[model samples]
Target: MLQTQSNKSSFFVKRPILFVIVVEVLLLIIVTVGGAIATIKELDYIAAIWVSFTPIALILVIYLTWKRKWGSLGFQSLSTITKQNWLYHLPLILVLITISLKGFEDLSVSKVIQFVSFTLLVGFVEETVYRGLILKAMLNVGVKAAVITSSLLFAVTHALNMISGQDLANTVVQIVYSLLIGVVLALLMVRGSNIYPLILFHFLHNLIQFLGPEATGVTYFDVIALVILVIYSIVLIKSLNKKTIKGSIAA
Candidate 1:
């Protein structure tokens, strides 16, 4: 057992990307099989399966195979919020406004609990895997490359939703939107040096989407909201870049 564990550790250290890919494939298999079983049985257990299994698998892999610290995987305690850190709040503001506009109605306690739990799980798992492990692994190449590569991977992973019977057009939109969101969250993680806020924002965004009023079809409002968010993210990234350059010069 010890020799086998050592070999696994060495393998992951030598090929972190491959490790991530293998773990992701495992997750996809688990979700696909679990979801199919749930559908066949008419049970609402997909969220529970994903929420429980993905994180546990990721934690075990990171702990046993990779030997990485949890803090390195974005499990750090909250940091002090400065002006720079405060900009990370923009996404949360947008989420809240969108939810308000959608006019949330009261939900049963059980449904609310389910929505919140699933969103929080998604936020934790995705950030830890993509922004935490993958982004950190790629940083030796360059920060820009790391951010872009991780964000793209994050977006592409949404294609799995298609296998779960999501509409193709909607899934495409989700993929694009996820790319944008990933970039923004990645920058925020860099700026804040903490991933807790990103997890919270991600959870809030998903919760809003889940509980807020559903749209009948694509609307102008959705386009406008997306545009505003993209613009905000661009400005935020530029601002953070400027700060970094100035700090480097002063140092």
Candidate 2:
């Protein structure tokens, strides 16, 4: 009798969790196939389009789920998390400034344009996938558990990317950096209840990193600075929780 009861409890806990995992796996598979095809065809632009389309598809899925009134399926609580705070944008700006300064020496008009495009593509794709879809789906499991689970998953995702082409030390270091940023993004989503701030910071982060001529070795230091920024944002949020999400939501 006790064993049966325990099994039932486990089933309940695992059910919703499995749904999100399945969705993520599906997405990864799709992207992998697209990437392979792009490689075979030697079409970098096709690959870029394929990569950029994933987030757009995910956002549409989320919107459709919400419209259909499907309960907690694939980022369904968009309405619940639209609240905003002006203070949230402050950290975003500071983070952007710091990152931009590092990359400024290599700045040129063409580089700026490329950086802008990269920022929008990567920022939107990742924010939608990581914070928006993953977090919302995990929330269906439980709030606290969602945050911790998604944070770890976000960090681990970076590890796979790092292993593909990046150095071993950088990959390990990125795992740590990814977790810190993951926590910050998750917390911002919860506290600000909006996606814009996270999106902005993500865009700026990538823009700075990719635009610069700085060597890959120096990126370790950049990660260190990023971690500090995350810590500072947390402290600031704690001190004035009310101001953290003041004017962020769209009508």
Candidate 3:
């Protein structure tokens, strides 16, 4: 009887996290379906903005609920900026510069407008759903599980773009690359507990991809860079774990 009571207590303790996860997933589904219908009706801009802002709205909703239930807002516990954080963002800047230079030749006013509108809308919406709510739930469950699962979820969501004439091969590549980006973002999320930095990087990444022309194939340099970063990040995460464990034990 005592064991069963303990199990129930544990479940109840985790219910808030689970509730947030369910709400976020449901909202994403509704937004996606509604956006699809709007796109079909040629209301692409409107749909895009709606989908993008939904996540941000949900984040605010969650914050309010959490603040009421707990004493403080959830965002208060997020990671603060550090020297290492700035250094970590350097690679992302390099990637952005390269992408911009490559796309400069074909840039036009109409494409720029479309790209900015869609990219901002999608980035805010998707990151809030996937990284904010989904990630929060996963991290509440287990750190390693959260990192892997969120990354996969983020990657698979990219597959939905295929409905709009994106080639299968290109879609596959984008998904793979997105998974890597997700892994990096997940690392940042786990480190900082804040969503702002991840959101900024994600927005820039999408903006470049949307505005840039002919991002069809992964270059040899990109492949090499991906391999190096994946290996290095894995090692770094492991080292971080060891340090955290040591610190906890000492305390």
Clashes of each: 0, 6, 1
User: Quick one: how many clashes does candidate 3 have?
Assistant: 1
Residue 155 alpha-carbon offset, candidate 1, angstroms: 1.6
TM-score of each: 0.78, 0.70, 0.71
Q: Pick the candidate with the highest lDDT.
A: 1
Compared with the true structure, all predictions reach lDDT values of 0.66, 0.61, 0.60
> Candidate 3, residues 1-251: lDDT per residue as tens digits?
01233433543236746655565576667767767767777776545656546555666557647534211111333245456655665666665665565554377888788677667666666666566656655654566766787788788667677876887877876677778878877665565445666667677877876666656566654565466557646754764565442321121
lDDT of 2 by residue, 47-157 (tens): 455564555666655764644412222233345453344555566666566656654555779868866876677677667767765776565455566567778877876
Candidate 1 ranges with C-alpha deviation above 4 Å: 1-14, 45-68, 240-251
TM-score-wise, the better of 1 and 2 is 1
Ranking by lDDT: 1, 2, 3
Q: lDDT by residue for model 1 over 95-126, one digit each (tens)? A: 45764576676889998998888888787777
- Least accurate 10 contiguous residues by lDDT in model 2: 242-251
* Candidate 3 clashing pairs, residues 3+ apart or interchain: 79-192
| Prediction RMSDs, each to the true structure | 5.6, 7.7, 6.0
